[model samples]
Target: MKKLSLLILITVLTFSCGNKKSKSESEPENITQVNPAENYSGTASITQGIATTITEDIYTCDRGRKTDVGEISSTDGKTWIVPAKTHYLNNDFPFATDLHNSCEGLNYDTAEEALANFNAANTITIDNDGETYTAYIFADNYFEMYVNGEPVGKDKVPFTQFNSSVVKFKVKKPFTIAMKLVDWEEHLGVGCEENRGKSFHAGDGGLVAVIKDAQNNIVSSTNDTWKAQTFYTAPIEDLSCVSEEGNYRYSKNCSTEGGQDGANFYALHWETPTDWMATDFDDSNWPNATTFTNKTIGVDNKPAYTNFTSIFDDPEQDAKFIWSTNVILDNEVLLRYTVE
Candidate 1:
């Protein structure tokens, strides 16, 4: 089954949401900036002047959103990675709420150091010829272009809004993409209005890219997913089952098994460990449906995995199950994956 996958599209940056507009100072300086263009060895070349490339490939909190990957290239045709972060400078700001600084991850101290660190990081390889063209990159807030070792482009600042600031870069051949991150708040100013004194948590940040030709014809694109360092813990649900004539398994649908209209379902195939048995299995001890709580529940994405287990009696025995999001109450269980 094709489940709705997560995306890292939006930026963790501050937002201008809500009806009441907060009177902020003239938008602060763009702490983010891309250096001059240089030569590189890939497919496209920086024939004229410098070609600075900006991308939003950082991680974010919002999942399943669309993002952009700016088009840029170097003189040698080599692909260069852009570095980004939440806050470029070390400026302390208030959080959105009175609780802990909602902004969890921000501030990449010392721009040069952060840039150098990013440059030294591994290079991303993008290969596509048939249908799917894909590239991988890890950025924070914004991206700066560089070729071979020289840099390029104007001091490009990524947008603070969720899905803004999607620039394009020109590429043709296979090349290495290196990148770094910056803390945008350093120049933008964090939580100035209502969040005064409230600690703002650093937002999830990263990169965004789209496949397009030199003439600006879009080919394909990648979506966004959670970018912050937070972890996701999946919960488990139980669905008891009855065996058929000679078989020891059964199948049922989720809606028929007590699932509600707004109920979020996740199906997983579980097998009893070799040491355990369906007869010896204690439903109270293992994960159950009630284990899932604090839900933003609704039917959206499909379950990541689904199956059954009969292994408790014999690990080597072949245990099978028909997986599905439509679960049977007494047939199988659903796992609730939560973010920590």
Candidate 2:
């Protein structure tokens, strides 16, 4: 009986040891391992100490609307994965209360004239204390901005449903800011309006902008303080004529060539300025910019603009006509501003 008990105890001890060893050996060598940095197969670059990687090709409109029109890989988790059919606005951002137009009234002398005034450009100049400044601008069609004759940037999107642009640059005490605005015309001759004839639609134009210093103080904006001049004018002539298409009647005779009339017709009545965008350009004779209130559109929809009073005092005057006397015949306008 003693021998049997000893044998059983020995057998139990061996089984326990075997089970412990098996359990220990079955455990993983390491429970956690660090993942290696992903090897991205895309364009990578460092600019201004900021690293940017573009994993997939992006298509952008001339005005800077970005769309992912290329293949996206799921193999690398680092790639920015956008859902299928995603649309991106300029700079991959959204804005509010930026939509403004000078021709919302459409009661101007002619549709072309309304569009031209809306297309007019203004240059605003404000003295800076040698500090960094930022600017935000938006136009009906489009605008190109320059600081001291150095191109800063232009409107990302041109035409209706306006998009705003932001630019930052260092400035001296007194600097010149110039902008060229254009009311994009589908037909070089006729403006963009709805249902003139076949595709004869004429569109209006306008521009509003604001600038701030490093302290975030308002320095400049689109207002009466800026000077403006029309460098291009078209379509609206003193003479009136009917189009062969009979889709719409013209307030001016756009029949430059026989059969090439109506929407396809174009005529220029103004001359462009020579190097008007230069800092030294003399605009002493230019008229002050007319203040127009964007009553049709407000901050509720266009939040990008903050200084409503700079354009108009009364919100009820929205969509009211504000333009120079020559707006009816001018197509292209040059604006000048010198920092005081």
True-vs-predicted CA distance for residue 49, candidate 2, Å: 52
Candidate 2 overall Cα lDDT vs. reference?
0.45
> Per-residue lDDT of 239-330 in model 1, one digit per residue for the tens?
22221222122322212222111112211222223322122223232221221111211111211100001111123422111111112122
Which regions of candidate 2 deviate over 4 angstroms?
1-129, 195-198, 237-266, 296-329
Q: Write the per-residue lDDT of candidate 2 for residues 138-184, one digit (tens) a residue.
A: 55545666777766665544443444545666777577877766655
Taking all chains together, each candidate's TM-score versus the true structure is 0.22, 0.49
- For candidate 2, what is the total of clashing residue pairs? 22
Candidate maximizing TM-score: 2
lDDT (Cα) of model 1 = 0.23
